[model samples]
Target: MTLSKKIEHLEQVLNQPAENFANSFKSDIILFFDDNFSENNTQLFFLNDLNSKEEIQSWVEILTSRFVMKFEAEFEAENDFINDYLENG
Candidate 1:
């Protein structure tokens, strides 16, 4: 898939509700990089193509930050629910 398509796929996955969010994210990211490596002929391209490597690195950083924010928000919401239940019960 093209870079845009891959990004779109990631966005889609990010929006979906997953029973296991971390595992889902890991599996999707692994598949995304695997496809990228195949498209570039191999992972060695990362070593030779500075621009491509930088672009991918940027994306990884952005994605990781987003994932962390999302996970934290979810965790806080769940924690709040548990606290409310305990207080009310």
Candidate 2:
């Protein structure tokens, strides 16, 4: 997906009512610019305005599963740290 499209999709996910994020936290988004998406400076936002242990665990699961499925080794050999962080951080 294009950078803008990815951000738009993520925005939709982040804005979902079921997420139950703090209003102030919603505005404090953390976006990571990936070298893998250097063509468009694709931003990967793993988590945002998370305030509880459950949210943190949810973010970890979401990130780990997404990374393993989308960015498996062959495409990101040099970015092992990123994948590791996503899984273990």
Candidate 3:
């Protein structure tokens, strides 16, 4: 998938109702990065002007590792959501 499509997928996942624990966990990841990278509600600064697949993957990898490390217990139950979000792109 293209970067744009991946972003769209993220939005799709986030739009789902957080009625269950699994969906809520996915929302947490999406919301964290969305707020973390937001600047006046614009594109994510680090993700903006990306030029290659490696750069995108690297960014995702770094973010995923850091996020997982910071929230290991919560991430353990829904690791695949992050993996799919990053890798499917």
Candidate 4:
């Protein structure tokens, strides 16, 4: 299906009552369309942006950050910088 249809489908799925869905669930949604299609790809990207918006309900959280268990010294060194910014700013 096209991106628009995929987005509409997601909205419909999310519309179910709280009891209908599990507390933690995983869904993989992909839009299959030819690259040479005439329509602009912007609409697809826009819909993705909406998915991460705060206006959406509780279950819709965008995994937009790097979720890593561990990293190298370089990454650890920056932790102080981040913490300082958080403390000061």
Best by lDDT: 3
TM-score of each prediction: 0.31, 0.32, 0.36, 0.26
TM-score leaderboard ranking: 3, 2, 1, 4
Candidate 3, which segments miss by more than 4 Å at Cα?
35-89
lDDT of each: 0.43, 0.43, 0.50, 0.34
| Per-residue accuracy of model 4 over 6-58 as CA lDDT, tens digit each | 45554554444445233122121112212222235442343443443342333
* Per-residue accuracy of model 1 over 1-89 as CA lDDT, tens digit each: 45544454444444455455343444444453453433344432332322443454454445544455554553455334323322342
RMSD (Cα, Å) of candidate 4? 14.6
Clashes of 4: 0
Task: State the TM-score for model 2.
Answer: 0.32
CA lDDT, candidate 1, residue 32: 38
Q: Which candidate model has the greater lDDT, 1 or 2?
A: 2
User: lDDT per residue, candidate 2, 1-89, as tens digits?
Assistant: 44445444445544445433232222223233331323343335443344444565466445545554555455554245344664466
| Backbone atom clashes (below 3 Å) for every candidate | 0, 0, 0, 0
Higher TM-score: candidate 1 or 4?
Answer: 1
Residue pairs that clash (backbone atoms under 3 angstroms), model 4: none
Q: Between the candidate structures 1 and 4, which one is better when assessed by lDDT?
A: 1
Candidate 3 per-residue C-alpha lDDT over 21-45 given as tens digits, one digit per residue, 9 for 90 to 100: 4344545566655633234434443
* Root-mean-square deviation of every model: 14.7, 12.0, 8.7, 14.6
Relative to the unseen true structure, what is the C-alpha lDDT of residue 30 in candidate 4, on a scale of 0 to 100? 19
